[model samples]
Target: MSRVLKPNANNLETGTTTVGMVARDAVVLATDRRVTAGYYIAHRRGRKIWRIDDHVAATMSGGVADVQKILEALTLQAMDYKIRTGLPVPVKTLANYASVAMFSSRPYIFIAHMILGGVTEQEGPVLYTIDWYGSVTEERRFASTGSGSPTAFGVLEDGYRDGMSLEDAIKLGIRAVRAAMMHDPASGEGVDVITITPKEGFKEIDTSKYL
Candidate 1:
């Protein structure tokens, strides 16, 4: 991660952290948006976090190109599967499929960690972290992943609480990223924050509002 921070200005460097806070019957997904190029800041508003469908969203970190490809493939697959089956893919089923696809990629392995968040058809909101090998597991109230994750997780552990409101959740997410930027060499200055709730699929919120 530190290596990415010290590269040449023309070389693209990126790092991210996804936080999922679970409440009684809902979940709030958030991420710190930071993408750099070597020592230079390239994009402050790069939305590394996104919704894959009406009820499923993900926040990803790692090799940018690999992550993008995996996301595109997964999106297409999900759409096709849904169209054919006439039902949204179950969260567990989608996670399992992603795991298989990512684990099988050869050339450049997808060194990415993504937080898959959404409300299940039968259950309430669910949150899980998926890794490069496609390993996925449920999280508690909150979880963070990526190069800056160690630091971000610290902040989250301190601020996270059950039944947190959307505004509070956003604040905690920003605070966690801010804390990470202070200590993580790979995580830079600018923070891009996004939110995904049951009503709203995915929405990028103003950093100033959270900061």
Candidate 2:
């Protein structure tokens, strides 16, 4: 049997900010909550961070509907892979699946960008950026997406360091997203952050206080 996931109609046109970083022991993912529709602000508490599995999560940008569609597809693929193999899907495999999906949909006008981060038994902490056209790049340190990425990259480049503690990585992720929110008109409202570690898997941090 096959399952099909429907996209959210209302979020077809939206703007956002998303960032992901790989630290020594964990991977950090963050994004702004604001959803923009052209010059208007549509939703303030929109969710851009998606949890794919216990150790994998994704941050999204571009059309929310397309983002949701891609996430749904990835989630289904992960579940099927686990059921068939009795093992969790690796971070790279998931990235490759997403890349194929994006590339197949490119000619149809489906557009979305994603930053996927996770911890695996073999790869430890890893991060990958999947562009709208299905091009995937494994980012050794960090990656950012959406309209505010330029501003977010500034903070990430300045603050990120090798082998930093997970706490410090979370703080840096927050700082990067916060800087983008402050400067990017399309990115604002609040920040959502998640950390993936071998011990605790994927967990979301309460970042309301940071805004």
Q: Put down candidate 2 lDDT per residue, 1-211, tens digits, no spaces.
A: 0011333434332357788998988999988888877767888888889999998999978776778899999999889999999887999999999899888874564567789999989989999998767889999999998778889999999999999998898899999988988888889888889999999999989876654
Candidate 1 C-alpha error for residue 188, in Å: 2.8
Q: What is the C-alpha local distance difference test score of each model? A: 0.68, 0.84
TM-score of each: 0.81, 0.91
Best by TM-score: 2
Give lDDT tens digits, candidate 1, residues 85-148: 9876666666777788887875435666677777665656778877766678888678887666
Question: Which candidate should be chosen as best, given lDDT against the real structure?
Answer: 2
Which sections of candidate 1 miss by over 4 Å?
1-14, 37-42, 106-108
Residue 93 lDDT, candidate 1, scale 0-100: 66
- Candidate 1 TM-score, true structure as reference: 0.81
lDDT of 2: 0.84
